[model samples]
Target: MNENDKQPDGSGGPGGNPWMKSLLVWVCILLGLALFVTVLGGPSATATGNTVPYSTFLDKVNEGTVKDVTISREQIAGTLSSGEKFRTVPIADPTLVPTLREKGVTIAAQPAEGGSIWVALLYQSLPLLLFLGIAFFVIRQMQKNSGSGAMGFGKSRAKMLTQKEGRVTFADVAGIDEAREELEEIVDFLKDPTKFARLGGKIPKGALLVGSPGTGKTLLARAIAGEAGVPFFTISGSDFVEMFVGVGASRVRDMFEQAKKSAPCIVFIDEIDAVGRHRGAGLGNGNDEREQTLNQLLVEMDGFDANEGIIIIAATNRPDVLDPALLRPGRFDRRVTVPLPDIEGRLKILEVHMKKVPVAPDVDARTIARGTPGMAGADLANLVNEAALMAARLGKRLVSMAQFELAKDRVIMGTEWKSLVMTDDEKRMTAYHEAGHAVVRVHTPASDPIHKATIIPRGGALGMVVSMPERDNYSYHRDKMFADLATVMGGRVAEELIFGHEKVSSGASGDIKQATKLARAMVTQWGMSEKLGMLMYEEQQGETFLGYSQTQRHNISNETALAIDSEIRALVDGGYDKAKQVLSDNIEHLHRVAKALLEFETLTGDEIKRLVAGEDIDRDAPGAAATTVPVSGTSIPKTRRPKGPFGSPAPQGA
Candidate 1:
């Protein structure tokens, strides 16, 4: 039979659910009828006038003889002639009628007035009574089983994914090569049982998949089940729990037994830590039922009964809180980490998702991968889908590189909040502010070249200048940090240069946040501050939850923290002042760029570069920046200041 045919009847296994309880009650009823029949008389007897004449006949006759008998009711008489007759004596064993018939006695019948009322009532009501009883019992059991709508406290909340139902194979799973290679071996072992058995290698009872959510840990489990071609039972750790005691333990037992029956199968429990958390780590109420569930899970996993062909695969993002017993050698013998996709992995993921999308010739997976650093598989998938949707909205046949870029921006910053109203003055100030950023970026030596700039509002920003890296870069130098800070201050400086102290909106709020963080790290974290002199104030402690760190820095005292904060603020202020000075020196160039923005709403990096070099940025103007001058493809490169101007070495140093 195919794997699909082997799906256990959804009570999740071959043994039907609690319907057996109803069957048991029915069997008892049938047995009761049989016993009553045996003690009363023989099967051939029939009741005569509510009295059984068969008792006397049974006492007097041998098993093989015909007999005559007389039977009487309250107001009627009946006679049976078999060559002899006696006075009518009525007795009360109505069940003896069959026995009299068995002796070959002929009895006379009186005209019937009414059928036996009690017998008729029982015959008519038994079926309905049995049905109602079974139904009520089933409802009660169902309610109790589900804990009256409360999942029992001890139940494991893992999700089940059966092999036939979940269709993810290695091809379907993208990214995370190391995790896939490790799990592929499990699938191989399951597919060829003897290969390991001949070597006397005991199968591991469980393999724990540890990683952050959206890293494809659960997806890996599904792929294993698909490759194994066996029953896959999926459940979440929380699914096994309930408010009632013992339910989680019972579920564990049931799950294990089911896995054993479907030997050579995979049982995937996602988020196993819900029930497998360390004991006594909680508020330590001795009555805590999670502890019981965890204890039972340990016993089932490493207990005396070897879990022969059943392989348990579980996933948890929170591995730190898992019980030690659950991670013991005999229990979860292997742990496979599914980390975020690196650059190459991200590219591969893009390709996998790209096959489903109709993309333009210019849309390169490599280009998208280079843009999205530190993105997980889930995010990459979203990027591809978003690009397709964007193309559709623009009435394009396929997604182009432009669509991909726009989608990336949408994902990074939220979608543009277009309806937010701004005055003409605010818009003009925003134009100058963004032009300042563009000018500083193009003029900065260490900055990545600007790809595009826009004064059109997007994601709560009145304008933005995008400067993407030329290729994948893992590390940033100190020069890059300072250039980044200068770019951040470009807007504020431009405002001061053009408006001469007119109030500038807090359009740079987010920029200030980003710049300040980088600056503080330069001082306290990276020790790039000259006054601090290479002494790291906060040690490079990584991978904390949110911003909460377990590794406390020893050297950073209250006084030091204050000093660090002061240094960071001073660094940002200094960068801002430098940007203002640059803008002051080039106020005329700043106005030319802003005027072009207010007119065109957008401009390319090349066009803005010419305008900075004293050429007309407007297409209608004489010697416009767009008008090509016949010369070599390149020219004398100007010596521009760095973009951030001191913002480097701090954020990326570690």
Candidate 2:
């Protein structure tokens, strides 16, 4: 046999050769037995015309020479008695006429065949028996390897990554500018341990990446491994637990042992809060297995020093529910925050993802970024991919701005329900409703500059008005908050004024929720309510410092909550009254603006200003200089705010 046929352990093959080695002894024994049977009672060599006497056959058989012979039992009685005849072949000598029967035996003449039946039975049965023995041995071995076929109950769920599948580097991630910067230092530390060790500085034993789901925490961890050029072992916190007791602890030990052997490596456990949740907080059965896993993890992190060059990285979106012990200073010494990207960050993300896609020149990444205000990296990537698909469907060579727009609408809104036909009156009503928001926001001084207004139904909304900040604002002044509230209520107010209080749909449900939440927070959480005093009722916890303390406030009485509710409703109602009056006073301008909005579904801030300027309102006044709110991290000059017809400062910021 070739080398390929050899067993893996290099044994001489199977044990079947041992049975073959004893073949000679069995063959010799079979031959000797045949000879003895022939000598004890033999037949005559010749085919007898007359039957031989039994006594004569016995005397001739003592010579042990029988060639071929047949005899009748009555003819040969003394040596052997045979009813059935047999052909007697040569035993030893041919010349000797063996007796037909001897020792009270007789034979009868018969036509006969010549072989031993016992030998044939032995030949067939021996091989069959050997094959059965081999099959049984194979089955016993398989049972042992399968752990008695019990592999199904408690299998580990961790995924394995080897050198063949190349690792992810920081470059692959996009849009998370702040998060990437924080993790870059980690890569450096893992690569050159001596750089810190020589100066008595120790690398952090663990780092926790906390963010909303799909914010690329896990991706960043993999980048660290790839950038460091080290082996990476990944497992979920849930993987450590099994059905049996002590299994979780054993898995923890095994995982760490693997990391140590492949020193200068990373161990990434995603969704660690699964096993690292607050102990004793679960319902019945109370997560004892999880707690054991957590304890073991604590020991492993504690046992490893920075010199070992084995770093642990973990990620969780729900940082609020994690155990304080797990996030302590000694364990996860560094905490990386991955927040939602802003407009400029989104533009950068789009640029990175757009490299592979064929896009038209007019398809602006900056504009797309501004449109997706709260999108994460994953969402932006999906938008790019969606835009490409839209272009392909239209048989376009490249993704155009129009395709991007369609893709954006599809992502934000469900795909267009073109079959859901609307009457002309309904479409006009939507136009006027959206126009009301644009008109009021353009005229109102406190609202942010209007970016676009559209009557086209999107994301289940009959219409939409997109207002963008001239610059980013970190803090919202009370006047700005009240202004935003008015703008939100403007669409509904406009519908009421034009449609004369007909049935209103729940199109403004999301806007109402957002407005109400802000209004309530201004009263209870932010202490913006004058009547409620400046005591913060709702706690605001920093995303990074979560789980380190009990961040709840002392509960107030139900009477106070009622009072708070009343104050919030009163504040929103007052804002709505102000917005309605503003729209009503400019009824003529409102009509002209709404008509323009219906004509062209979108208008820029400048276009709206020109349209509303229709030579009717004041344009200039003393102390009308636009107030500039400092939006941090921005150097771009703010666009001037809209002014009244007489140059009077618009009622902006109230």
Candidate 3:
């Protein structure tokens, strides 16, 4: 056992030992017997007599000092006239009885009690037995608490899931269709192994579910089990390891032993990275207990002893950190990537979740899916739940489009900070800052369409200008990146233009930081800087030990580092200049939109465009009129407002 196995009191838990419980039962029985003897036989033995010689007994009787006598086969006991007690050995003389009668003493006779010697011996050993029982019980309790008793430390903690009623099948899962399809084959293979076996193919020993967190990797694994209708054993990677050196390895062996017995089973290990990290990658000798566990796991998965009917399905977001041995062909035969849902996938996910709620007709899943570009299935489910909650809070029978819109805002931007009170000047500044972003996005050709602009505080932002992409965008071009850079700079430029540079508040600090990160990524990561010539300079850092870097290896020279910094600054300045130019060119539009935002606190893209066109917005109108807003010496084509829940276009950019 290691340091982790040590308890504060250094005793094992009660349940740690099987025999300790029996000892406790014996202790209770002994105590009960002791009490019984003390209570039932105590009265008869209460009169204890002092031992005296036969001559003395005779003298006492002659003096008339003895009150009565009780005689057994081997002894005589009598009480003196003074109420004192005495006992003496009987003589072989027959005149003893008659002498007692002449003295006018009352006499009684009784048989001797049996087994008194054995009873005394039991009483002598009871204390020692009780002491040993208590010691064993304490040791058992300590071992149970530390979860490292002699017999229990090596047991596997994998829980065999018996999901009967709420079992999830492949049909219930949506989004990441590719990952689902890959897993469906595993389900098919499990259901009929002969189908694959006849083709000279063994069931893939394992399938690795690689995805970002909440991308439905674990759900997919369960769906495979449900569809196959096989036994499912689930355990976390951390469950196999303990502070003890060999406990994890022992557990791995035990888990495999169990899995082998329940053949044709699926063992789902969530977050395998906890135990499957790259061996010898961290500091120290790298032969820790976790590594030992991983080694055992590797051997169990694809060692000399083949585990025939067992399929291992493990999920982890950090696949890059996993040991190569664990990911070898014989171990994890297939690596299934469960990427974030695309537009269609998101719509299907929304539809699946919306089925559980009472959504009004106004709810449009496509528009919502479009609005949420990078959200996973879990996120969409949460969005639907939030919408339903908001509708319930508003005393609505059904979740409407308005609730969904609010929920989307809540999910993406965060819960609205209604309690954050802002002064008039601060509110006006925020309105203009958001308006600046909107105007610049609308005018920039490569920029995504503006979805909504608001001066209401949400999360850490006093206001935000949201833009929605026309469709799901997988990659960004240089022009679009430039446009985004410019859009982010709009807030800071607006603050400077409205209030003097010296008077600008720290409200633009987030915007500045965002812009800086984007610029740096473009320069060093995206190879967008011409001066840097498509060369990658930034070193990618992965997981480290105890919050310390294993190595600080700078591959670039000082001159190269300076060049990268200069390129980043140039990109940011260029974006700032572009935003200033766009905002300056469309100054009138910027003011009108900002004033409208101040009045409404929030405005959709169509409303902002209408405001730019100097049109009065009819708040009561369900679908407002279309209008062409002027932008940078060009007129934006007239586009009608999308009907249904999302009043604005889908959000595209963050």
Candidate 4:
């Protein structure tokens, strides 16, 4: 039988789902009755009776009109003189038999019945049997719905994959080459154990993949099974920890028992932290179903031999909370960390995802990868799908670069709020705020190049300025930190510049919070303050056992705390002053960019750069207002900066 078509013996088949067996039992019982009737020739010659009046029945007996009579405890039934059967409810009298005898009527009392004891017993027990059958059916149904039957809380919920099912192989996966390399060895061992065995080598009994969500941990496991041409058993950690105690332990044993039969197989348990968390860390003593399951898992892992060819792989984002015993050498001997993909990795992932889609020739995967930093493989995959969907929404033949760019923006900044309406004053202020950001990003030496500056409302923000990093940055130096802080502060500073501090909107609230957070981190975490020496302060000590990073432990004195707060304030003020000075120096250029943005509503990185350089950016075309050029592509038409607002067209040649 196909592996996918079968459930574990106790959980399925005739012994488990007994409808067919019950039907068969019913058929046998019916057939037995039919045979009994055929052999016994039906009920034997039952006497038929016509109910009569009691006085008439007695008068008939007295007049010699009765032929023979049968008397029972309640009624008199007998044949009359004309050979007609009669029955009547007569009074209970001791003289009834004597009166009938004196009337010269032939009467016979009913003889003692044979087999009546067994008949009465059968009749009496029928309702009890029926009640039991109904109760058993209800209980059985309840068990099936709750994923167990009777005391069957121990059944394994692992979904087995046959050869024809879930055919994902190594080709389906891309990026994370390091993780693939470690897993390929397991596949090789599964395919040809003799090669590794001859070298006195044994594969790891299990591999634990630790990573954030959407990093393709489970996908990599299935790919291994596909490459090795072995069955795959997939289960979740919660599947082990059921409501009943010891159920989880029983399920763990059953899962391993199945995996042993399908040797050379891969068993994948996703989100294993549900059951594998550090025992005794929660409230109370922590001897719960989850703990018992974890114990059983430890025992099963220790019971299995690495050379047995049944490899177990588990994935969890909360690896810090897992028990140390569960991760020991004999258990999960290998720990593979599936971190998010880097730029090169992301580019490869995008290419793999684009293979199934009809992509435009102009769409470049490398360009997209460069713009999307610190994205996981699954994120890239979703990005590709979102791009395709955007293209299809426009009724386009193929997914284009335009769709990809828009999709990236939506993914990063969230879906646009196009229905939002803002006053001209609000629009002008937003333009200036974003322009300030763009100006700082361009002039600031360590900042990434401004990707796009737009007053188009997206998510919660009225305007956004995207900075496309030239490449993936593994580390941020002091200059970068200063530049980032200044950029964040620029929006609020611009609002204060254009609209006075009293008139400034609350839009800068988020920007101010971000600036403050970065400044505090600079002084406390990075130790970048000149006054404070190179030492890290624990703002919050994380609990490794609980899988949470929230506990404030004071490592410094109250005086030092005051000094740290003072240093953070100084950093923010300094960054804000630096940004305001830059805007003050290029005040005319900042207005020009804002005017262009008012006319066009969006500006590309190159356009902002050209504007900052004081180059002409007026497009004569009429419909060029809503669109902008790609980062590396040809520029679209840009209308002349509107003469209205933004301080009367930048003061001409001033």
Top candidate, metric TM-score:
4
By lDDT, the better pick of 3 and 4 is 3
True lDDT of residue 15, candidate 3: 38
Cα RMSD (Å) between model 1 and the true structure? 12.7
Ranking, TM-score, top scorer first: 4, 3, 2, 1
lDDT of 4 by residue, 1-654 (tens): 555556665334435546656556655765665555444432223546888998888778778888877776556788877778878876877887898888766776765555555555655665676667667766776677555657666678898877586588888888788999999999889888899889898889999998877889988998888888888999988788777788889888888888888877889999998999998988877868888899888888886443376788999988888999999998899999998787888888999999989999888899889877657887788889899998999899999888898887766556677677889988898888878887877788988777677887765567777666777665568887788778877877887888888987777666665567667767777678989877787464534344434635357899998998999899889888988998888888789888988887878877788898989675555744334553211111111111111111100010
- What TM-score does each of the candidates earn? 0.68, 0.69, 0.80, 0.81
Residue 632 displacement in candidate 2 (angstroms): 34
Error of 4 at 441 (Å): 2.0
**In terms of TM-score, which candidate is stronger, 3 or 4?**
4
- Residue lDDT tens for model 1, 596-650: 7787776766778878888765465775533322111110011111112232211
- Candidate 3 wrongly placed segments (more than 4 Å): 1-34, 37-45, 48-66, 69-150, 542-554, 622-654
Query: How many Å off is the CA of 116 in candidate 2?
Result: 20
**Which candidate wins on lDDT?**
3
Tell me which of candidates 1 and 3 scores higher on lDDT: 3
Give the per-residue lDDT digits (tens) of candidate 3, residues 1-654. 766775554434433444555566776877797986675445346557898999999889888888899987667888998999898888787987898899899999866667555666667877886787678777876677545566687888898988777799888899888888888888888888999989898878999999877899988988888889989999999998799899899988888888888989999999999999999999878858999999999999999999999999999988989999998999999999999888899999999999999999877899888878768888889999999998999899999887788888777666667677889999888878888888888888887877677777765567777666788765668888788778878877887888878877777665665677667767776678888888766644654577332323358888998998898899889989999999888889888988887877878888887878778777756644222121111011112111111112221222
RMSD per model, one decimal? 12.7, 13.2, 9.1, 7.9
- Whole-model lDDT, model 2: 0.66
